[model samples]
Target: MFSRAFSNPYISKWIVQGAGIIWFLGTFGLLMYYGVGQAVAIVDALIFALFFIFGVNIIDQTFNFYVPSGRNNSMLLIFPLLFSLVASYFHFQLLRWIFDEESLYLVFLREVFLLRWAVLGMAEILVALLALAVSKLEEQKEIKNREVMMHELSREAELSQLRQQLQPHFLFNSLNSISALTISQPQKAREMVLQLSDFLRGTMEKDHQQWVSLEEELTYLKMYLDIEHVRFGHRLEVVFDVTDEVKQLRLPQLLIQPLLENAIKHGLYGITEDVRIILRAYKEQNYLMVQIENPFDPEVAAPKGTGFGLSSVGRRLFLLFGRKDLLESKAVESVFTVILKIPQHK
Candidate 1:
């Protein structure tokens, strides 16, 4: 409780000011004792301390309005010097009036007039510099806070744009597939339309969600795959190799669908035979590791399309985790594989 009270700026300032006033009174009291008697010395010290405190407050208030900088910093010394001279003059006059009959004490005061001015000047100048430093620190803190807020706003805008782009890209492809099946297989086209509606509804619901359990993501992926299955018929096959333990872990919402879409596009395009795409997930220490495997022919050129899915996912991962190595891909022999690692937060 005491530490917390001192942490407050107003309380700390008053404490320091009180200590300084006590120090000034003690020092002047001892000095005045050499010539004046005890009662007169106490009066003299009290009056001088009042003038000293007033000079310090004036300096503090001046700096509050305009802190000197660059060429004008010389004002810092000049103001304190002038204030000390003025205060010392008034203090000496007041003492002389109060102790008109004390000739010896008057002589003592005249002798130490310059010394008192010098001491007060130094104290006031120290206070001015401290106030200037505090002002500069407050300015710098505000600037830093503004910069962080702007960066956060920029990041959120980019993430929203990336999410919006994915929906239209997948929608166009689904609409094209449905158009192709309308004449020859009207029933399948109607089924795909319904599946597409459900998938889009789920996507809209999860658009604002940043994270979800692995099981929830898998359910959303199943909806997406249902639409794809209608378009591909028996040629495309996807196998899930996820355990119950892994399904309880969490990942970014809709993060896995793009990887699966990439796998299907590369694995099935221009291929006449049936293809199997496998997705596996498990826990590896502090991270949840997910890997997708698909077979692709090197000799056959894949269909040309915008590679936005993988790139957007990579960008999203970097924005979320500040790590570029979280998403990776490689091809070995005829098998293509993509690996994604998500940090598990307890």
Candidate 2:
């Protein structure tokens, strides 16, 4: 009956806060019953007040540290009983010495023993309540962790589906370029096919890894860009600024391709002006700083697509690193930028 409602930190803290009121009532109750002039009674009550606080904090840690289910409840009862017995005995002995009328010995013994039994009963109920609260918290924690795991797995599956969708779209575009080249320039058509094959080989080789070294992913992306450059000619240009120390650090595969595609498609959609894609990668303290920015065309609205590419990267970053604060996208006038910050793993 005591285990479920007040098991988590929110409820547990509330219970402890309420215990402050309980402690006040118990201390004042004992003081009024025993009389304030009885110094031993006052001191004994104070000791028990301290005991309540200590018992609560210690039991919270012990139960939550995972003492094994079978042995846990036994330890819970044993600790409070032993502590109370010793405290009650001291309380009784101190009173006996103070009164010193030997005839009252029997009466004192009689009353003290009865009081000890009552104290034990109260202690039992309190300990039961506390242990129950701790048990509930542990169960709730396990449930929350499980929920997080399931969410991450679902996101991973969605990402896989998105990658599949993208591959075909990317391939179809490149194939059209090769088809055009087959008639206009036969020699260049053969070279484009070789590059296409190499690019597909790289993509197929990475079917398992969600992440790869920056250098490795960059190499693959450059192959794809080479094919696009051949098709677009002077219409597209790419500039890469990467630090030597961070090239070997691992990052999500194809992290920059979507951003590059967004830059060219939207940044140059309406006008015949040449579009430039600049990608920057460097280390800022302990973080991997990646920025994909372009001077977007002010005259054109956004392009037509699924509208999930940038958001997919944002969501993936948040899920992978547990960083609700890291991924950011900003745009003003002619410039649109996506900033990706992930913990650098060497």
How well does each candidate superpose onto the true structure, as a TM-score?
Answer: 0.86, 0.56
Model 1 lDDT per residue over 1-346, tens place: 1112245868856765685679567856676557568788777777877777676567656655676889999988998899899988998999899999999889988998999899878987887777677767766877999999999899989888887888888899999999999999999999999999999998998878888999999999999999999999899899999999988899888789988998999999767899999999999999999999999988888778735778999999998889999999998989989999999998
In the predicted model 2, the residue pairs found to clash are 7-137
Report the CA-based lDDT of candidate 1 relative to the real structure: 0.85
91-183 per-residue lDDT for model 2 (tens digits): 567656654564444364447665764675466547656576656776888799999889878978877876776678677767888899999
- Candidate 1's TM-score reads 0.86
Off by over 4 Å in 2: 1-148, 179-182, 186-189
Give the least accurate 10-residue stretch of model 2, judged by summed lDDT: 1-10
| Clash count, candidate 2 | 1
State the local distance difference test value for candidate 2.
Answer: 0.70
